[model samples]
Target: MSLSPSTLSPPPLSLYVHIPWCVRKCPYCDFNSHQGRGELPFAAYVDALLADLDLDLPLVWGRTVQTVFFGGGTPSLMPGELIDRFLQGASSRLRFAPGCEITLETNPGTVEHGSFKAYCDAGINRLSFGVQSFDDGCLQRLGRIHDSSEATAAIKLAQDAGFDNINLDLMYALPGQNLAMAESDLEQAFALQPTHMSHYQLTLEPNTVFAARPPSGLPDEDGSWDIQEHCQAMLADAGYRQYEVSAYARPGRECVHNLNYWKYGDYLGIGAGAHGKITSGHDQSILRRWKLKHPAAYLEAADSERGIGGDELIATERRPFEFMLNALRLVDGFSLTGFEASTGVPRSAIQAQLQEAVQKQWLLVDGDAVRPTALGRRFTNDVVELFLTG
Candidate 1:
C-alpha cells in the first residue's frame, strides 16, 4: 500500500486535544471555536475526549507520545480534575515520554477564576495564554473578552502558580494599533519573561465576522510590515529568537509539540474538530483524520465510528507540497535526507523545483541542507508554489 518509492520512517509523536467551547468567540478568530451558552459540559466532554482517543489509539499502537497539547476554544475553562483523569486514562493506554511537554492553551479571561496550581499538579508543564494585545481599545475592537490588565494578571497568576514554561500569544497590526502600541505590547510581554511568544500580523480570515464586515482603521500592508519589523527587533533584543514565522522562544524553550509538527512528525488529534496526521511504517503511508466539528454531534458520536468526520490518504504526487507546507516554515529549513524520510519520496522528484528556486536566489542549497533565502522567506508562498505545481 506504499504510495512512494522512498523509504519512510515515523517521526516523533504528539497528542493534540481540542476544546470547542469559548466564553465569547472573538470576531477575528477563524478556529473551530464556538461561544458557550451556559455551563459547559466539562465532565461529559472529558468522557467523550477519552472515548475519541480510544478509537484512534490503534493507529499508533507501540508509539510513545512525545508531547501533549490541550488546544482550545479555551482549555483553561476545563477544570483540573478532569484533565488529570484524561491524562491518567491516556497514559495507561499508551506510553508517554518522560517529561513530556503537556501544554494547555489558556484564555486570559477564563483564567481569572481558574487554578493554575491544579493544572500544574495535573501534569501540565507549559501554558500558552491568548493575550492578543495590551491595548484595551484594540482588545475591544477584536472582541476579546480580556482587557489589558486581565491579561497581565493572568500571566502573573500562572507564574505565581509555578509555571515557568509559559508562552504569550500576541498579534500586531490590529485596528487602531500603531507602531508604538505594538511596541508597548511587546514591552509588556517581555516583562512577563515567558519562555516563548507567538507574534503575528492579524488578518481577516474568511467566514469570520471580521472578514464579512471589515474592521475600521485596520493597518495597511506597509504599516503592518513596519510593526512586524520593529516588534521582531524588540523580541530579539529581549532574548527571544525567531524560530518560525510567528513563533519566538528563549534559548532551549522552543515548543516541542509544535516543532514536531513543523518537522512533519506524527500526532493523534482527538476531540471535536481535532485533526490528526499519522505515518504507518507497516504500510509506508500517511493518514490524516479529523473528528466531527460540532461539540454536540461529536459528543454523541465519540465512542462510535461516526465520530470521524473525514479521512484522507496522501497520494504520491501531493507529498512534496504537503511536506514543504510545514518544513519550509522553519528558519533552518530541512535536510534532504530528512525530507525523504518524512515524505517517503525521493529527493530527485523535487530536484527541478529545487534547482529553479536556487537559480532564482530564492533558496540556498548548501550540500544536503536547503534553506530559504531572505527574499524567499519574504515570498514563502511563491517558493512553496513551485513545489505545489512541480
Candidate 2:
C-alpha cells in the first residue's frame, strides 16, 4: 500500500554542506570521504556548492535557515576564503537567521594556528574537533592522524582565536582501551573546556577496514557497558549533562544543527554525498534528496539535474518509525503536538506502540509529551522497532 503524505505547520529548516575530502580515511570510518591526492580544488568546490544550492533554492525558497553545518572528511580543510564565499553566496539566495549557529568540523592535524580566526570571520561561530582519544596508544590503534598532544594544542589555538563554543568528539570502547584509559581521555578533554562533548562507542561499520579485520582486545559487551556508565557519571559530575545518548553539553550550548536533525526538522544538504530531508507544505509531502556520492560526478553535474543522486518521497505509513528514529534519541523525548504537526499523522496512529512501550517501561506518556524511560533509552533500537509496520 502506497502511503500519502500529510502535513500541518512545517518544521524549522537548516542547511548542511558536505566537504568530502580528508587527509586520510580512518579505519573505523564509513562516511563518504576520499583521501586527497594533492592540492584540493577548494575554490572550484565552493563554486559548485553555490550552484548546487541555487538548484535547491526553490525547494526552500523564502525559508530562513536556522542553523548551518559544514560536515565532511574535514570541513576545516577548506580555506577560509572559500568558506566565506560559499556562505555569502548562500545568504544572498536564502535568508539566514540573524543568529544562525554555523559550525565547522575540524581535524586537529589538518588545521593551523591562524585558520580559526579566518573561520570566525567567515561567519562560523562554532567548532567540533575530532579528538577521538587522548591516549597516544589508543590513537595509534585507532589509526588517527592527530596525536593527543596535537589535539590539545589545536583546541587551545581555537580558544585563543575567540571561539568559546566548541565540541570535542570522543570515542570510547576502543580496541585496547581500558576503563582507566577512557577516564584519562575524558579528564584531558575536560581541561580543554569545550562547550559540548560527543562521546560514542567505536563501532566497526561495514565496508570499513576495521570491520574487515576486527581489532584485538576490543571490549566485550559487559566491558563496553561499564565504560559507558562510568563516562556518563564523569561527564555529569563535570557539569556537562547528557542530553542525548552520545551528546553532552552545558545548558544552552547544545548543537543547534544536530538538535534540528534529532527533532526531525527540515534541512537542505549541499555538496557530494550529502542527504537532505525537506517537508513541503505546499504538496503536503516530505522529500528526501541526495547529491551524487563521487565528488567528480557531483562537480560535473553541479548546476543541473544530473547532480542529484535521487529523491524519495517519504510515505505516510513510515512516518511514525521515521520520526521515532530521530525523536526518541532526545532525553526529553518528543511532544505529541509537535509530532503531529511535523509528521502530518495523528498521535492515534502510533497509540498502540506508545502504550506497549510504556507498559514495557520503555516510555513515559505524560499528557501531550512522550519521553523515553531509562530502560527505553538503553534499548533504543528495540523501542524504535515497535513502530515499524509489518
Candidate 3:
C-alpha cells in the first residue's frame, strides 16, 4: 500500500560533518569551532563520526544522499586518510546518488597543494577556502593566520589539484575598512577566478571578542552601507551572479549544500555543536535533532545510544517562520509551490500578511513568490517582524 500524504518522507538527503577544531579562532568568528593544541586524534574522530551516523541511519533509509559537506574549524586539517575512511564508512550506511556534490572547507594557512590534491583523490569534489581578505593589514586585524600572498597561493593550489568547483569566503565591513579597501579585497578575489564567492559583512555578534572589547576598525552605519553597495556592484560587474544576500556564483557553480538549506531540504549534521533539521514522516511526525557542543564532551559521550543534547519537533505555526527565514535570503524568493512543497502547508496560511507587506511596499508580490524590495532588504528585521503575530 502507498504511504499517505502525511506519511510521505523528505526527498534525497544531505550530510554535514563538522570538524570542531581550528588552529586559532578568529575574533569575529562566532561559529561553534574551537582553538586547540597538541596532536589531533584523527582516527578516533573518524570512528566517532561514523558511530554518530550509524545512530541516524533509520531516518536515512531508502533516501539517496545528494550532497555531503565537510565543514568546521578546518576540515583540511584532518589527514586525507581520515577523510577517505569517513567516506568509506558513510557509504556502508547510506548510498550516494550518482554525481553527488562532496565538499570540504579549508583555510588557506592549513593544508598545502599536495594535501588538497589528496582530498580530491579521496572523493572531495569541491573545495571552499577561507580567504577573508587580500589586504595584509586587514588579514592581520582579523587575526587570520595566512597572509595575502598565501591566500592567493591556496586558490592556485586548488586549481592545480583539479578542483574547478571552488569557493572563496570573504568578509567586508571589517575593522579599519574603507570602501576603497573593500573594493581592493574583492578585486583580489576576482583575480583568483574561483567558481563561487561568499562575501559576508562582518557583524559584532554577542559573546565574540569584538563584542567584549569593541574593535577600532569597524565602520559607521553610513560607511558600512556604502561599502556593501559598492562591493555588490563590483561583484556583479565581474560576471558573478548575486543569487543570495551573501552568496555569488558563476553560471552553475552555486554550492548545492547551501541551496538545500535555503530550500528547506532535510540534512543530517554530525559532530560537536552541529544542529540538524530532519523532516521524516515514518510515523506521521517530523523531528529535528541537535548534537551537544564542545568536542571533549561529545567524544566522551559517543558510545551512548543518544549523544545529542536536544531534539525538537516543529509545529505548524513555527515551520513557516523557519521556512521563510531561509528562503527569503535568496535574491529571488522561492516559488509559492516551493513553499508548499517544502513546508507541507498551503499558501493561504501566510497570504494575508504577504498582501499587507506588498501594500506597504516592503515586499514585491510576484504571482507565485514574494521578494523584498530594496528598501525591505535594507530593513529586513522590520520585514520579518511583520510576520510575527504569535
Candidate 4:
C-alpha cells in the first residue's frame, strides 16, 4: 500500500470524556468501568481530567470542537455541581463550535429530578439513558440497576428538564428473551417518544462474568434474528430511521458525535481509558492514542509525561482496513473520494477488493458514491474483511 500526500482537508473534530466509575459493574460489561465503592473522588477526577486535556491541547490547538460526549460507567452518577464545573473548565480551555452538541450518558437509577435540570442548565443539550431492557426479569439477569418503571420516569424527567433531544439505549436478545418480550421492550421504548434510540444485541463479551459462566436461555441465532426483524419493523413504523447498525433516530436527530466517529473524523479523548484518533497535517499521517485504564493510575499520572497509556501512528498498509471498519457500518456507505481523502491511500490500492465486492453483489458503486447492499449490511464484517491484507 503506497501512501500519498493527502489533498483532502481534516475531518470534523469532537471531544470524548470518559467517566470510569459505575454504581455496579454489569456481568456482561467490558468497558473500562469499575464498581463504585464508598465516596467517589469527584473533585480529584475532574481536576485530573482538565489537566489531561491541557496536556493534549497542543495537538488540537485552534480547532473548534463540534461536539462533546460524556460517556462511561455512568456520567449521571457524578454530582450536578461537578458536571457543571467540568463543563465550565472545558469551555475555558477550548473553543466550541456554534451550537455544539454536548451529550451526557446517564442511568435511570441514578437520576434525580433536580439534577437533570442542573445538567441542562450547565450546557448539556443531549442525554442518553442506559435503559438496557424494560422487563424487570431481564433487567435482573443483565444486572442492571434500574427497572422498567424508573427508565420511563427518567425520560419524563429529562423532558421536564428542558431537554428535547434525548436518546434511550435499549438492548434485545437477553437471557430468556423471546419475540414477544423483545417487542414488548420496543413498545415501551417507543411509548416514551424519545427522539433517538440505540437498539443493541446483548453479546457475552470476553472477560465478562457472563462469558466466564455462560448464562442459560440466551436466544439462539434464529431466535435473535426473529427478534431483530420484528423490533426493526416496530421502530420503522414509529418513524425512527436506522442510521447506523444499532442507532435509530427521528429526522435530524442522529448523534453528531457518533456520526463523526463513523465518518472517520478526528477526536480528542480525555479521562481514564479514553481512546482518540487524530490526523496530522504536518505529515499526513493518522495517529491513535489512549489514556490509562484505571482511574487511580490515570489520576496519579495525569500531569506526568506518562499519562498516556500508549499511542501509535497507523501503518500505511493498515489504513484501508481501519477506514472501512468504521465507514462501512453506515447504511448509506461512503464515497470513493472520501475514502482516499480520509485514509490517505489511493483507490488503486483497494480497487481489487472493491471490484470483488461489487461482483458478489455486496456493494453498489455508482459513480463517486459506494454503498453497501442489503446483503452487505447484513454481513458487514465479511464485506469489511475484503479489504484486509492479512
Candidate 5:
C-alpha cells in the first residue's frame, strides 16, 4: 500500500556530499573510503558531484535544504577552493535555508597550517574532527595516522579559525584500553571545550581488517560497559547532555544535520557511495537511492542513468522497522504523530510491538510520546527488534 500525498507532505531536507579518499584506511573502518593514490582527482570529482546533483534536482526542486554535510574519507583534504566551488555549484542549483548548518568532516592528520580557516571561510560553519583517541599508544594500535599531539593541535587550530561549533570524535574500548585510560581520554577531550562530542566504542565491523585478524587485549563486554558508564557520567557532569546513544552536546549545539537524519527527514546524497532518502510529492512514496561505490565507476557514470547504483520504493510493511531503526537511537524516543508522518505507517501497525515492548519493560508510552526506559536504552537492539516483522 502506498501513502497518500496528504499524509506525507515531506519533511525538512538536508544534503550530503561524500568525499571518498583518505590518506590511509583505518583497520576497523568499513566505510567506502579508498586510500589516496598519487594525487586526488579533485576537479573531476567536483564536476561529477555537481552533475550527480543535477540529475537528482528534480526530486527536490522546490525544497530548501536546511543543512549540508561534507562527510567521509576526510573532506578537509580537498583544497579550500574546490570546496568553495562545490558549495557554490550546489547553491546555484538548489535552495539553501537561511542559517543552514554546513559541516565538514576532517581528521587530525589532514590538518594543515591554514586549511581549517580556509574551509571556514568557504562557508563550512561546523567542523567534526576525527580524533579517535588521545592516547598515543591506542592511536598507534588503531592504525591512526595522527598521534595525540596532532589531535590536540587540530582542535586548537579549529578554534583559532573562529569555529565555535566544533565536534570532537573520540573512541573508547580500544585495544588494551582500561577504565582509567578511557577517563583520561574524555578528560583531555573536555579540556578542549568543544561544543559537541561523539564518543563511540570501537567495534570490529565485518569485512574490515581488524575483524579478520582481531587485535589483542580488546576489552570484553563487562569492561566495555564499565568504560562507557564512567565516561557517560563524566560527560554529564561537564554539562554535555547525552542526546543520542553516542552523541553528546551542550545546549543548542546538537548536530542539526544528524538530527534531521534521526528524525527520518529527507536528504539528497551525492558523490561516490552516498545514500539518500526522499519522500516523493507526486505519490508520497518513500524511496531510497544510492550512487556507485567506487570513485572511478561513479565518475564514469556521473552523468548517466547508471550514476544511481540502485533505487527502491520502501515497502509499506517495512516502513515501521526502518523508521524505528533511526528514531530509537535518540534518548527521548519519538512521538506517535511524528513517526506516522515520517514513515506513513499508522500507529496501529506497530501497536502490538509497542505493547510487547512496554510489557517487557523496554519502553514507556506516555500519551503521544513513546520513549525507551533506562533498561531499553541499554538493550536498544532488542527494543528496536520488537518492531521487526517476519
Candidate 6:
C-alpha cells in the first residue's frame, strides 16, 4: 500500500564523497581503487564532484547536512588545498547544521604529522585512520604499506593537530594470527586512546587476490572465532562499547555519519564508484544512484548525471529487507516503531517473520526494541536469510 506523500516524514541529510585513487591497492581490498602514478588532478575532480552535486541538488534542497563522510579510495591522498576548496564549495551550496560531523578517512601510511594538521585546518574535524594491524608481520601479510610505528605516529600526529575525534580501524583473523597477536593489536590500538575504533574480522571477499588464491596460513573457523572473541573482550575492557558488530567507541563518540546510514537516512553520494540512496518527499519515492566506477573515465566524462551507471526506484516490498539489513547490525537494534517510521511502511509487514525470529531464539524480543542474540550475531547471514526468505 502506498502511504500519503504529504504525511511521510522527510529523511535526514548526509553526504558521502568518494575518492577513488590509492597509493597502492592492497592484496585483499576489493574496493574501487587503483594505484596512483603521479600528481592527482584534485582541482578537476573537485569540479566534477560539484557538477555531480549540482544534479543532486534538487533532491536535497532546503535540507541541512548533518554529516559528511569522505571515504576511500584513500581520501588521505587528496591534497589538503583541494579538500579545502571542495568543502568550501560544498558548504557554500548547501548549509551545514551547527556541529555537523565532517570525517575524512585516511590511511596511516599516507598521512604524516604535517598532513594531519593540514587536514584539520581544511575543516575535517574527524579522522578515521586505516591501521589494519599493529604487528609488523601481520601488516606485511596483509600487504599494508604502513608499519606499526607509522600508525602510532599518525595517531599522535592527529591528536597533536587538535583532533580529539579519531578512529582507528583494526582487523583480526589474519594469516598466522594467534590470540596473542590479536590481543596485542587491541592493546596498541587502545594505547592511542582513540574516541572510536572499528575492529573487523578479516573476510576473504570475492574477486580479491586473496580470495582468488586463498591466502596460506590463514586461521581456520575455530581459531578465527577465538581471536574475534578475545579481541572484543579486550576492546570492552578498554572502555570501548560495542555499538555495532565491528564498531566500538567511547561514550558519545560513535560515528554519526555511519549511524545515519544504519538508520536508513538519505544522502547525496559524489565521486567515482560512490553509491547513494535518497528519498524524495515530492513523490514519496526512494531512489538509489551510483556513479561511474573508474577514476580516469569519471574524470574524462562530460557530465556525471548521465555518467550515473546504476539507478533504481525501490519498491515498498524491498524496504523491509533493506531497513532490517542495516538496523540489525546494531547491538541495541531498533524498535518496531522505528522500522515503520524509517521506511514509511506498516509494522505488520514483517510481524510474522519477527515473531518467528524470536521463537527461534535468533532475536531478542525485549522492551521497546528487538536485537540479535549473540548466537544470531555469529550466524548473521542465516538470521538475515530468515527475514529474506520468510
| Model 1 segments more than 4 A misplaced | 1-6
lDDT of 6 by residue, 243-269 (tens): 998999999999999988988888889
Global lDDT scores for all candidate models: 0.91, 0.93, 0.84, 0.91, 0.91, 0.86
Which stretches of model 2 miss by more than 4 angstroms?
1-7
| Residue 31, model 5: Cα distance from true site in angstroms | 0.3
For model 5, the stretches where C-alpha displacement exceeds 4 angstroms are 1-5
How many clashes in each structure? 0, 0, 2, 0, 0, 0
lDDT of candidate 2 over 1-390, digit per residue (tens) = 333244455799999999999998999999999999988999989989999998898899778999999999889999998899999999999999999999999999999877998999999999999999999899999888999889999999999999999999999999899999999999999998899999999998999999999999999999999999999999999999888879999989999899999999999999999999998888888899999999999988988989999999988888888999999999999999888888888888888999999999999999999999999999999999998896
Per-candidate TM equals 0.98, 0.98, 0.95, 0.98, 0.98, 0.96
Pick by TM-score: 1 or 6, better one:
1
lDDT of 5 by residue, 1-390 (tens): 345346665889999999999999999999999999998999999999999999999999799999999998889889988999999999999999999999999898988758987898889999999998899999999999999999998889888988999999999999999999999999999999999999999989999999999999999999999999999999999999999999999999999999999889899999999999998767868989999999999999999879999999988778888888888889999999998888777787788999999999999999999988889989889988887876
Candidate 3, 120-185: lDDT as tens digits: 888999999999889999889989999999889888988998889999999988888899999999
Who is ahead in lDDT, 3 or 5?
5
Which runs of model 3 end up more than 4 angstroms from their true locations? 1-12
- What global local distance difference test value does model 4 have? 0.91
Error of 5 at 311 (Å): 0.4
Candidate 3 global TM-score: 0.95
Candidate 3 lDDT score relative to the true structure: 0.84
Prediction 1 TM-score vs. true:
0.98
Q: Is candidate 1 or candidate 6 better by lDDT?
A: 1
